[model samples]
Target: MYSDDELRPVSALQHFMFCPRRAALIYLEGLWSENRFTAEGRLLHRRVHDARRGEKRPGVRVARGLEIRSYRHGLVGKADVVEFHSSSPGQSPQVTIVEYKRGRPKPALDEPFHVQLCAQALCLEEMLGRGVSDGAIFFGRANRRVEVPLDTALREKTLAAIAALHELIGAGRTPAARYQARCRRCSLLHLCLPKALRPRATAARYLALATQPPAPDDA
Candidate 1:
């Protein structure tokens, strides 16, 4: 169990899954640089996150910007939305987490997103003292939801991520950058400079070697 001060944001798991260096860059170094992708995502979620309201539709209740946390996992964050589906008048409502994304569904590249959703589900389960069986990721581009199961495997993975996140934040040391295909889409690409600061050399060495011309006699 973790105290309020020790709890970390659930979003860190997604960043950590994407790249440890990127997580460190944001959470450790306090650096950020927004690009088109992040700006669009921010805009897409602005309406949902800014409002804390709920609506009812027959057997379901939709909550927007619901705050959640899990002391057991030391995780804290808000779900974009959570739906409570009542089966009967007195039966417990099924909790379902719905996270908003900026783009269309790309299952191949949605592992991090899934993990983040799973974390939220775990938080809800702990907070509400009920089992959270499933959740969904709503893609704004397609205006559709991709369902995700909060099975044991995903739960285990999310717990692992939470533990690792606490370890990362506790150490107070940022991981080094390593270039990857996804880095191109990261908003902090400019600040991280994964290519320039990758292992085996420093940014100065990379820049000096890349910029300096070959010697006249070495041709």
Candidate 2:
């Protein structure tokens, strides 16, 4: 188990899952930049994190910008929202997390979303000593929340991501930039320079270079 000081931000898991090198660029190197997508996302979270904003309704209570941590997983961060729902007067309230996103959900990148929410649920379970069975992601574009179950598979993925994140941080070295289609949307694209950092050689060039004889030895 990690101490309080050793805990990493839960949000970094999304970065690592999206791109290891990108995560390194941000956390390991302390690099950051603002793009349209990032700006929008920041604003969305800002609205959700309003300190004075909260809600109480019949059999339910809502907290915004609730700080959460999991020493077991070495993760810590502020949740967008957490709802406590009680079915009966004498029953314990069910804990559920709700995360907000600026963009609509994409099928291709769904696992990372699940992993992030699961991490939050894991933190709540440890902090509250109550089971957090599920959560939801509020998509700004769609204007809806897509509920997610904290199933075994998702928990496994979340744990895996947490482990990999710790491993990356422990290594203390930024990974090489890798150009990909998704890099276009990343806020760190300019700083990351994945395209420029990529090797300027093709498979044929590598084959030709490999077949070349060694130059004459200079004593």
Best by TM-score: 1
| TM-score of each prediction | 0.89, 0.88
- Count of clashing pairs, candidate 2: 0
**Worst window of 10 by summed lDDT in candidate 1:** 210-219
Q: Give the TM-score of candidate 1.
A: 0.89
In candidate 1, what are the lDDT values of residues 1-219, reduced to their tens digit? 899999888888989998888888889889776666677888878887777578888988999888899899888998999999988767898888999999999878898999999999888989898899979999998999889988889888887888888888899998877888987677776566667776677868778655654333222
List model 2 lDDT by residue over 1-219, tens digit each.
999878999999888999999888888899887767777889999988985667887877899999999999999999999998877778788888999999998878877777888999999999989898979999998898899989998899889899999999999999887788998677776566666566885667555544554322200
List residue ranges in candidate 2 displaced over 4 A. 201-219
The 10-residue segment with the lowest total lDDT in model 2: 210-219
Off by over 4 Å in 1: 50-52, 199-219
Q: List the residue pairs that clash in candidate 2.
A: none
